[model samples]
Target chain A: MKKIIALLLAAAMMVVAAGCGGEQSASSGSGSGSGGKQITMGFSQIGAESEWRTANTESIKQAAKDAGINLQFSDAQQKQENQIKAIRSFIAQGVDIIAFVPIVETGWDTVLKEAKDAKIPVIVVDRDVKVSDDSLYVAKIGTDSVKEGNNVFKWIDEYMAKEKKTPRDGGSQYNVVVLEGTVGSSVAIRRQEGFKDAMAKSANAGKYNLLASQTGEFTRQKGQEVMESFLKSYGPKIDILFAHNDDMALGAIQAIEKAGLKPGKDITIISIDGVKGMFQAMIDGKANCTVECNPLQGPLLMETAKKILAGEKVEKLVYVDEGVFPADVAAKTLPERKY
Target chain B: MDMLKKFAGSSLFLPVVALLVLLVFNTIFVDGFLSIQLTEDGRLYGRLVDILNRSCSLIILALGMTFVIATSGIDISVGAVVAISAAVVCTMIGGRGDGVAQMPMALAVLAAIGVGVLCGMWNGLLVAKFKIQAVVATLILMTAGRGVAQLMTEGQIITVYYKPFEYIAGFLPGMPLPTNIFIALAMVLLVAVLMKKTSIGLFVQSVGINATAARYAGINVTLVIFLVYAFSGLCAGVSGLIESSLIRAADANNAGLNMEMDAILAVALGGTLLSGGKFYIGGSVIGAITIQTLTTTMYALGVSADQLPVVKAIAVVIICLIQSKKAQEMFDAWKARRMSKQNGKKTSVDGKVAEQA
Candidate 1:
């Protein structure tokens, strides 16, 4: 019994030593003492499960470095509970600022209130959280999903007019099939309504038909599967394919090609989210248009954090300026696309 | 009365009744739910067809799950195995623009399934040889499998544009149903025949009931367990093919998310006990369709996607209660009380008259 107790004591000491060893290296890498009284910020990231998210993480890290802020990072790996736990840890550590991209929109009330009580400002990025108190987060930085949706349809109208196939001019009738984002997600619902509302306002609203729209869940594979079903069900009548994100559009390109149709020529594809892959697709002439949702909100996020620290009242909701990039313009913008 | 008692006594009874109830509910609440129309292209259309079509992947998984659970072992890695299989096949196809296969489809498919078989063998090795708990052993792959899939696809969704590949999941020329349906049926039949015709099924039951006893009885218990896990892996492989083919791409992140739970639930809903022993593959197949029907019914009821899970959970709990032994006991007690009450009054009146005389 004496020997066993001694061994356990040794094990506990070893764990403590190992933990200190890890912290020393991490702090040195982030360069803590080079700046004067460096502002420590704890960021809880929703894991890099996709290319867009990876870019988002990189952008945030790069921005923190440029500003010389001590950034504490945690990855939630797509779970709300983990994000909440990370937020609690930030509170315990007494960081100057807490920032996160929420995995979901609900169940954040208690955590936000706790952060508020701790007197540390929380900044939300990429996604929104539902808290009854508006001051839970100093500022929300995200894309206007509905606006992005509207931009894509507007681009489609321009593309049609350039092709001398304007339905408004009584040129031809067209059918559209929509590939939506994750079902019941804010982005999916808003994007679906945005484009539909745009089309309804078009001069040839009655001439153009909304064939079918199904949730692709904003993933490439489901995008392809849903597109395959659309092809089988609607067949040659589908002229316009509007996807909520570029991932789905890229997936649908495969299905359209498999069906022996030239995606850009035979079926015009319009998508949102200006990921680099979409730029490549645009250059390849497989994708027709992409409205940028710009995943690189890190610099702006930090900027807002600084302003809040300086005691300036920042906008409660900060809308990132975005653009619609057509296939013709993709070549020029391909070299400059941030995400 | 004897027939009714026998029918109720069978393990298949509850699952069949659950399916019937769902069907009746859909037919009543969902308009044109029972209608099956033939499309101009010789394909079947309607919600019923859709249910069967969608349930194909789940059916394949549950079929394998049925065997694993029968051995008192659980394999949660089947879903991960699916992602790996999809990754291998799609990357092997190496389709570029429009997903045209650069390589031969047969070789790609065989290699994918081969990987699946190997994964199963690994699970078998851990469970049967290393003596690790099945759940713990399979959990290793369940967490790591997606990562492996991501590695194969280079963190991208690998799309296959190969036309012949579509025949695996999509409808064939002049066929009214998807080819996957036929594949699922064939797998069920093959497994059913193999289990019933040979002594393997009995051997599995013995091992599950008591491994030491089965060993004393001269049964190769280790081999039986290994073979069942290996078979489960193969089922997952075939399921992966159908799933990836359905989408014509392999999505590492979302390929078969939460599918293991669905497969396990199907097995339980089919009336298989979690503790192991006698199993029914047909009941599991029907259970898979029942799950699909529930989803379709929810959609028909205009339940929002976020709220659908809550509704499904409540319904599942109710169905589970109905299937429980406790519920059966309570029901039997009620019946006995009513019968005894009717006879007691008559006997008491007759005794009074006799006494008076």
Candidate 2:
């Protein structure tokens, strides 16, 4: 009986091994067939933690199909260790190119060095990586939070000017209150710095009084709670409300409406991340403007990957083009928003 | 004076005093903190109302947590269960451009609560039948429940545009208070009556104090443990409905995030021991209110968001110290020493007078 059991176990192991071997050979055979040798790219994603992230993943997948790149996608489920494991596996699989959205800023030097040694070009997408050697990755493709923040101020300035109520021209002082994102996050810090820089540089800098600023942790619930207290303390004195993200702004709009005040007219609301919900809010006249930090980087990433594989020199830092969407244009753009 | 001392010695004393102190501080420093204005929509709007309105969910969560803790078990999965419930409700009521429900609204809510009770039953099965540790059992659901919710929502934030659905968390026509306040009150009353009228409370206490002993005393220990967890899941399910309705969306990632910690803290602040035995329902309710008031107070005082947690930690420490029996004993000892010192002086003076006579 013992001998028979051992034989059965050995047979099971052989069958499993054969199945894995068949899968690998079939994948490699298809990779070489097409028009020419298809470029196999292994891309590891930081999990779908939010709607914005899911849209970003969709764009990348769609772009890969459009660009005719053989994409090997792995989800890290928002863990750095899992991301590292996926990168190591990609190296072992000997993919031509490797890419990942690093969940954190640090702790990628070792796996990246391994990829560099394996002679595979690595691309960092979305959130950046901090490695000892910059040459480990060929290029970084993502949005610039600082530029997005600067654009917010510029859009507000343009909107005020268009209304013929330029604060620079000695118009009424606007009491601006801010709902910041999670404290200590790089995006939050950079966006805040960009806003402050634009404010200092503008002629109407002194007219926009910052009444209060508090962290809303970039959630609808916290945003509403904080906005409720802000409404009670500052009352109708607040003329402008700026949230670090659209979710917080959406939450604040609810609080504003509950307080028997019109959001867009009573308090000019501006926020980042032009999500679909935010566009709907704009159409409803509850929000004023949104400076998009675009998540649709699929085409750019695939194009960059093709350029690098073709041995063309590419810029190390590539910024995706984003635009400002105000209420007037929100109606036209709402239907087309893929996110 | 003795009555005052007795009141101070009660478990409810510390949380009540903490809440009063926070309210008094806000009244003194925060402008118009005490004033409640009738909005044009006929709703009462103020910091006080906001505290009550916002804390309603937490209060409900704490009510369930009180019973779970009484059984010497913790439901860390309450937060995840909340996410799952929200996902179930929101997906059932599809986000149509027109304000229409895919299914009956009542059925959707009942299904959400039913899912929550199912989750709790799974936890109860693991702990009561399999003899697994409560934390480990609940942790399984805590980790997997969010993923389940994400799957239900298809990794999307399902925004419910049904106008009538708003009344779950928002105001009904011409109502002065948010519907959530009434929902919370009804839940509390239900739990209060269950504990007062039924022997389930006593059975839970016996099982918590000693399960083997309780079984020997002809108590159904397994059933008591199972029922507490089910009740806790019911509370989380109701909370999930309120939360999802508040934002009109099922955010699988953020809905009821870290709320389990807040619920556990509320139970602790109510002077309930983690080891399980005696319990106080009203104290937990007051503790929930105190926490919300503390948060509102920090916002009103203009504390930076990064610094808010630190302030809250300090306040919690102070309240816990005030509730500590050792601290009260030390205070009584100090008072006794002062009284004895005065008596000693008088005795010495009398001795001197007797010697002179």
Point to the candidate with the largest lDDT.
2
Q: For each predicted model, how many residue pairs clash, with residues at least 3 apart or on different chains?
A: 1, 0
Give me the displacement of residue A192 in model 1, in angstroms: 6.9
List ranges where model 2 is wrong by over 4 Å: A1-42, A47-51, A61-97, A164-171, A306-313, B1-10, B334-357
Could you tell me how far off, in angstroms, the CA of residue B107 lies in candidate 2 after the best superposition? 0.9
DockQ of every candidate: 0.18, 0.56
Best candidate, TM-score-wise?
A: 2
Tens-digit lDDT track of model 1 for A1-339: 997788667656534543321121122223235545667778888887777788888888888877777677787767888888888877987889999999888889999999999999999998888888888888999889888888877888777777965432233677888888887787888988888888889885766787777767788766775676676555568888999988899878977865657898888898998877787788988988889887888789888998988899988999878888889999999888655
The residue pairs that clash in candidate 2, if any, are: none
Tens-place lDDT digits, model 2, residues B1-357? 999999877877887887788778889999898999988879888888899988888899999898889999999999999999999999999877667899989999999999999998998888888889999999999999999999999877788888888899999989999999999999889878988899888888888899899999999888888888888998899999999988888889889999999999988888888889898888889989888888898999999878888998998888788777898799889877866675677755656444533
lDDT of 1 by residue, B98-177 (tens): 65677789998998889988999999999999999999999999999989999999887766666788889888988988
Q: After superposition, how far is residue A229 of candidate 1 from its true place, in Å?
A: 10
